[model samples]
Target: MQVDYEVIIVGGGPVGMMLAAELALARVRVCVLERLMETTPYSRALTLHPRTLEILDMRGLKAKLLDRGKPITTGHFAALDTRLDFSVLDSSSNYTLIIPQHETEKVVEEWAKSLGVEIRREEEVVAVHQDQHGVEVVAVGPNGNAVLTALYVVGADGAASIVRKQAGIPFIGKNSTFTAMQGDVVLKNPPESGVPSYFNEQGLVMIVPLPKGMHRVVLIDPERMAVPKEEPVSLEELRASLLRILGDDLGISDPFWMTRFGNATLQAQRYREGRIFLAGDAAHIHFPAGGQGMNVGLQEAINLGWKLAAQLKGWAPDWLLDSYHTERFPINTALLTNTQVQSLLFGSSEFSPSVIALRNMLSNLLQIPEANYRLATQISAFNVQYEPDREMEPHVLNGRRFTELHLRLENDVCQNAYELFHSGSFLLLHLGSDERLYDVIDWSKYKHVHVVRASLAKGAPDWHDVHTALIRPDGYVAWAISQSESNPMEAIRKGIIHWCGHV
Candidate 1:
């Protein structure tokens, strides 16, 4: 059947744009239908976690974001005072970039456009339908409604996803029992020094600087906790919240943006339903704690992007398409739990002395480096690991996130391994001098895989025993063949066929 696009993405947020770009990087024909003609003005999601920075770094997009955002070595968990330290991570992109959501969306969108991704703004997708052959999306715009067809459709739409509903995917979670308010404004009498979160019987409040001449103030006020999320927030409301919690407004004035959000957490029963798939807020929604929402969505985009591209390009194994849900579902499940846990700490319902004491205790525990590192890895998403496929060679590196490796080329020049992934090709990195497999596997057939024979320039303890490794497009170790293997060359051949397709 003829399709308008290889993939049609609904929603033009960061996740949708990122997925579109990733697919386009592989030369897949893709389109994005968005309701807004322009990017959002407000800085919605404030921070990009460490793992997200790593993903962007692999694509060579991290430098642009670094130019636009502030980098912080620390991240928050449940509004704790000690803060999770990201500097301990072993990568150049270790710090969290405190860029506004708008900044992130624009970067991904520009990259997508540069790659020839067709984005139809001011077009809202109303419904999605799919069968064994293909999927169709109904969109409404100023020009009027139109139906678009594609081999696959992805829903990057928000919490109230029409795609999920149309596909009959159950959204499992509870309604919000409480809400929090935040605003970007000029803090006339701002705190003199460091920005710290305040938690007391009055309320829990956090204020951070934004990109423009504005500060983002977020707090869970006890008195205003039960207000519906749909209600509009006013400058007086924020001023009142400040006075109630911190005793002074910090000379708050000149409101730029204000809104109320709730703790209504939801997750899709499944990320994929036949030809239609879900990503970002369509897959899961949680209370905005630790600034992890948008970061998680962007991660999902990368995970799903290359797989979809592979499927459309006809190099994907049958199981490759299904692996997207298998891999990301559990990660997001933990994310939802983490947000709910943070919601409890934020005093979603009761703000009593005990809750205050609990927060203090956790904060103190985080001061210990071990405890801090444990939570830091989880919050930064460095802890993600997928199980190795049964057909592949078994190794510890299988399914683990690929850390940046300093590699020396055959010509003796050295460069970072992440630089090789910018083209979105599977990297067949043969660290040892085994070239017999090269003759066994026809190089012309596996055009989608980038085979590089290089040695580790710098010592990476785990990679020391690796004779060869197959790295996925999204920067994850798919298979690592140990030098100890008696038949290492054969394993390398199977690993390539396992991921890059038998063709």
Candidate 2:
């Protein structure tokens, strides 16, 4: 069968929609098939970390989310007393946004639609078969069962991912040994201090104010810790847990949404299988610790989207597509480990004195500047560093996340560096305008790469003395050439071939 599109994404949640929008932004023809006719009103995942905001800024979507979300300068680690101070992180968006999942999804879905993505709602993909040529998908929709083909298929579906199962990619991890309760409700007597958190032998309980005079309550109770995640949570159940743990539910009432979740962590053996790939929860899942579940998935969408588009457009280097798995797998592994650790600290191991003591020590340690910054980077996902290309001249900036840089263009007009990535293309930023740059490489042949001749408008210690650098569409530095290099222009030529060319 003829390929219906370059890529067909199965699942149209925030992750799927973000990926589709990225592809469409790069001029890749893509479609999304989702089982739900509308976005979920339940806001299970409500936090967007800093790195997530940075990537969204790249696509000009950050401003939209900013308008909808409330920003907080701190995040939790095991519901510790001293939280991770995101304000210390060196980013414009060095904080988590307290926006509900429904709001996030709506912002992304509108983005996907604005970019011309064909979204087929109420379409459930039952079977996905991929061969050497392409992938065939069978889905049931309102019209009837239908078959469609695409050069590649991505499963952004959550925990019970049909695409991942059909691809036969084993999801390996441990089953849940304990669970916790979460709810968004109206609190007649809310926390006086705005956001109140308490951790003790009784159990951990935190309450944060939400929009529209509502409050989000999350708690772990020793008595109900072993309840199966499938068991539904009720308002009465929350009241009992609060009275048992916090001695008062802060007058908890009128739950807009409530659910029981477990620490059953898992990750796909590999993110890709032949012509099929996995993303978001389809690739990995963990307990809702540090409010990082949704952020990690959104970041993955940014990482995978451009690489797939590059391959489809024929300018992607041979190894580019496979690098998606190589780069993301280990990161998810670390994510699962951190979540497990957080779960253990949340009294999953035992709601006793020992865990409480350990958590107290860690929380106190986090008050120290050095310790706080390290955990802040990890939870905010600012610590991610892609392995650099060894063949290129070694520079400290290589493989590092390209944080915001102010550049003075050839015309001497200064602008923030992120504006270059609006179209989701490789950015060959030539900091020093050596006229020999164009003579060394045929820039026209690499039309997909956006070459900018500019110098640093602001004094950046790490970027000082850099002749040039190549940044991947996902905002990671592909490679950088040091000013110490004897032949910088020749290095730029090789870097372009190593990244921007299909060969």
Candidate 3:
């Protein structure tokens, strides 16, 4: 049975395109099936958090994205009065990048195309079936119906995913409790409040700046809480909501796009089923708090992309593929919980004195540096830590993201940790005088792993007395060895086999 592609991704949005690029980087044959012939004009997600920026930096896309976005040093939590200071994060990319989702899609699509990833536009997936070897996807495109087969199929097709439904994956969560309207419009008289957000008994209203002199206006009208998701948003309704919430509409006119959203949250019971997998909104959906919807989806894509490619390439450990679900399911569950709490905090339809008091108390708590930093880490996703499956005692750096480090190698050559990840391979970085560390692993058998001996740059703390560390392709530490360890060579052998499979 010949497969048309090693992987076929449904939905060519940010998540789908990101995964396609990751797989293509590994020399995997991949294709994307997008229902729309052209990209959407609507700008859904408006910001990318710090961790997302770091992931892009690893792929060398961060500079290009920065050129297209506004780097904001601060972010908000549930539109709280207190700001989440991104400038204090312990990463090179210590800020959020504010860019429209359409622009982001364009950048990623361009990268995927450069990697020779085929995107079949206007192809709407209707049916999917899987066998022991591969999966067949039936879609209707401009040329009519067609069937394509791939070793694996990923559903990034949004909350109402046809692929997830056809795969019989349970999407369990709560229904919509409140509705909101968003519009990108030209203002005859713009408000003086720059990127201002207000929440009160009337409702919540926010105005954010967009490209091309257009402004994005979000309105949550208590009276319109019952509006169906299918209902169209009108300029008059938007004006009334703004007037009710913000005292004026700022003379909003010349609308470019408008849409309605709800607080319905859901998560797929499982991320994989046989040869089928799910990512992005197909796996989870929740309130658009902290602008995390797209960012989390992109992270999920990166986490799953390389593992799937490794499996197809026949070098993946047995637990590698399943780890995608194990690692990300909990993250998505926490995301849903946070957004639900935010929805409650921001909801005005059921506003009461107690709710206001609660909001005030939480807002005050955010003033504390530790409290603010903790929530900021969660929202920025910098606090994500995976538990290593190995039996050895875990070090502090194990299972944590390998932060970009300045290194001075043997020849006085200087480099950063992110530069080693350009090829999407495991990096074995030795940071001490032990040249014998390289002899421990049989590097000849691991084609995708690189070994480098380097010393930490001056003024950097000696990290956990770590002499050697194994970094996964997604930039997380698989395992690390300290100088005080009794048997470092044997530990390296076990770590390689645990993460990189049989050599």
Name the runs in model 2 displaced over 4 angstroms: none
Over the full model, what C-alpha lDDT does candidate 2 score relative to the true structure?
0.90
User: What TM-score does candidate 3 reach?
Assistant: 0.97
Summarize candidate 1's per-residue lDDT along 1-503 as a digit string, tens digits: 99999999999999999999999999999999999989988878989989999999899999999999999899989988899999999888788888989889889999999999999999999888888899989999998999999999999988888889999999998878899999999987777655578998899889898766678899899899888999999999999989999999989999988999988888999999999899999999999998898898999999999899889888899899999999999999999999999999998867899998899999999999999999999999999888886787688889999999999999999999999999989899999666685786898988888999999999986899998899999889998988889888788788888888889
Please give the lDDT score for candidate 1.
0.90
RMSD (CA, Å), candidate 3 to true, equals: 1.4
Model 1 stretches with alpha carbons more than 4 Å out: none
For model 3, name the residue pairs that clash.
none
Q: Which residue segments of model 3 deviate by more than 4 Å?
A: 458-464
Q: lDDT of each structure?
A: 0.90, 0.90, 0.89
Screening candidate 2 with a backbone cut-off below 3 angstroms (N, C-alpha, C), the clashing residue pairs are none
lDDT of 3 at 327: 98
Candidate 2 per-residue lDDT over residues 204-307, each given as its tens digit: 88888888999999988888888999999999999999998888868888999999988889999999999999999888889988888788888888899888
Query: On a 0 to 100 scale, what is the lDDT of residue 460 in model 3?
Result: 50
